[model samples]
Target: MEQGIIVTIDCETRTTREINLALREASLAQTPVRLSNPDCRHNLAVGVTTPLSVEIDGHVGYYCGGLCDGVDIRVAGDAGWGLAENLMGGRIAITGAAGSAAGATMRGGTVIVGGDAGARCGIAMKGGTLIVGGSVGVLSAFMMQKGVLIICGDAGEALGDSLYEGKIYVRGMIASLGSDAVISDLTDEDAAMLEAALGDAGIDARPEEFQKIVSGKKLYNFSTKEKEIWKTAL
Candidate 1:
């Protein structure tokens, strides 16, 4: 499979280290890479800071695009746990589902999942936008500090538990809200942002149909009277 100036790597024949080295070299050259037979390998393309575009033909295991900056990674299949973990910048798109903690502790960039995501989808996410075209499991945004999470399908129990400064938008049923998570009225500005975000993800949805979830601000300060809330969150 050859394209004009596109480098292709056969993951079936090369070791992970060799593949990554080749990726780094290609990135340095500012070339696009296409990987075939990824075979659910772990730790592929980790810590790459270059602004390269990568196309993976098959499923990828843990940390497929972790700790990257300014790269655009597209996985044609599913992704395992810790997908794009600690990502500083860039975009990671999974055509299929993603495992737990898909964007854990990521400070910036965008992550788009075309299918459902497992538990803790955006756990401890500090910044960035996570768009899930399908449902997300329990504790989806557990302890999220910043960023935006948009779920186009149903959300499981304890959605956005103990979050701070982050925003959540849900277009489907929410089983339950997590401690310190409360519903907030959507504003015109929010609608515009949602529209743009959904457009970027190529998801067709009306922003007005979604509901916003934000921190109740009760957990920001410890109060003796709010012990019950703290007990549940802590």
Candidate 2:
């Protein structure tokens, strides 16, 4: 397909390998592609490195759009585990709920989930932003190193557990905080950022309506003096 041309691939008629090949080809040419009847397939468009637009018409299974760089992908239905894992750049939008480990270990870009997300959402995320329009499950943002996780609805227990430098914002009730995670006063800069991010993601809440969670920095260096904190963190 030529660059700028809109390509449509029906996933129901092709093998996974064939579909991925077509995606890669379209990515190289910077063409916008639409995938029909994905049927919750796994590993579709795994490693396209160029900037392109892709629209997946139905639900997707594990690792969909993983390891991609600078691609704009939209999933029209629910997503399985490890959605957009290790993404290097660009954006991924999921219209429905996501399974566990969504956006796991991603280095950059944005992931927007229109519905709820399961456990360990944004786990070990290194950079960028993850915006969830609904509630997130337990241990969400666990061990997150960097980036921002915005939960427009409630958050489950141990949210932001053992986090290094990531920030979490929740608009609804938090069941319980994780070890070494502390609620901090929302700064003006934080409010501005939240406003921009939420606005961009099409989330309707104001920044002041949310609470910010950050690392207490007690786990930066383990010591016997802080043994009690270490016990839970470890």
Candidate 3:
């Protein structure tokens, strides 16, 4: 274990601003920290960059750990919208469920949800990996251009809708595939990637059970003949 300084802040007495300030100070010192009595406050620990660890003892609201880099953040309970949105690096984990747009537009690092995730999970993700140990809601991975979204359980309707180049893997049922998205045969490389991802997340799912979803590439170019069809792809 890496020995480091530790600080604890009580959210009950402090506003989110104060808590964030305290975290900033602690991170600047490269110290590990703990947050107690978090009452689902939005944007906790946003934009923190340090090689340290942060532990939230309870739930957090929207955008917890957003834009994080070079830190490890763990939430003990569920999270609201956009957890880890636009993340640049490092790792964030939710021990419970996550709300809409989890990992939205993230360019790097990893986000792991121990339970289910809501609508638009991994929306427009540019890079990195998102692992959901449970089901995902509708419109998951909508308009995703890069990266990987992995669902160990069922996926809701329009999964990967209008996706550009991102990869999606589901171990359970998919309610529907969105426009220009189709199931493809899992390759050996995909299995290796899935295994590594699940292992990194400490999830026990088997990669063989996962079905890969990728863009069909049928709508890469516009044509007058397929103008009506292109509308759905958009």
Candidate 4:
């Protein structure tokens, strides 16, 4: 186990194959691992079975940690598409920007992005907490189910198309709402829930300032006649 101000060193020389090798040899259980290189393109530390604190100093490619649990992960830079594709559970902190579909179809965990997120940020997210600081592009949460989509900045058009059984919150202006989602009037229960989730995600915005996006029930599955009717209409 390397110990000191610099405990671990993985220069992102190769794909994640080399990076994970460093992670495996680092003895992270014995020390705090820090990947200092910023230019590393490797998909480092994709699936960490061991519990450790890993901090990457720069942007990373897709599926940084597709599925991980019982670890504290922090990214000091931006992330590519599908940052945490199918996170089971853990705490992920992003200090920089994030790309499209940051947490696509994730089941559990918490994702915090301090900067803007690209389009389709959390499409089909089943469970988990996604917090985006800046704005997002069109179709941010299309078909989102069971989870929370927190947008501290504005949201683009057609948010949560055909969504079902999920909640979305935005602080800035909204461009449009999809067929399966809308800004429902908040009840006391909803306000409380939003406030609690935002608090857990380290977001300090008030519930009143936050706009909640609720999904529509139409897109859950296919209907018999209306399915064809809608298809013809389109």
Best of the two (1, 3) by lDDT: 1
Best by lDDT: 1
Q: In model 4, which residue pairs have backbone atoms overlapping below 3 Å?
A: 180-216
Query: Each candidate's TM vs. the true structure?
Result: 0.93, 0.93, 0.93, 0.84
Q: State the lDDT of candidate 3 residue by residue for 3-122, as single tens digits.
A: 455688899999888888888878777778999999998989898876668999999999999988877999999999999999889999999999999999999899999999999999
What are the RMSDs of all candidates, in order? 3.8, 3.5, 3.4, 3.8
- The residue-by-residue lDDT of candidate 4 on 78-111, one tens digit each, is 8887777777777788888888888888788888
- The Cα local distance difference test for each model comes to 0.93, 0.93, 0.91, 0.78
Q: Model 2's lDDT to the true fold?
A: 0.93
**Could you give me the TM-score of model 3 versus the true structure?**
0.93
Pairs that clash in candidate 1: none
**Total clashes, candidate 1?**
0
Candidate with the larger lDDT of 3 and 4: 3
In model 3, state the lDDT of residue 77: 100
User: Candidate 1: lDDT over CA atoms?
Assistant: 0.93
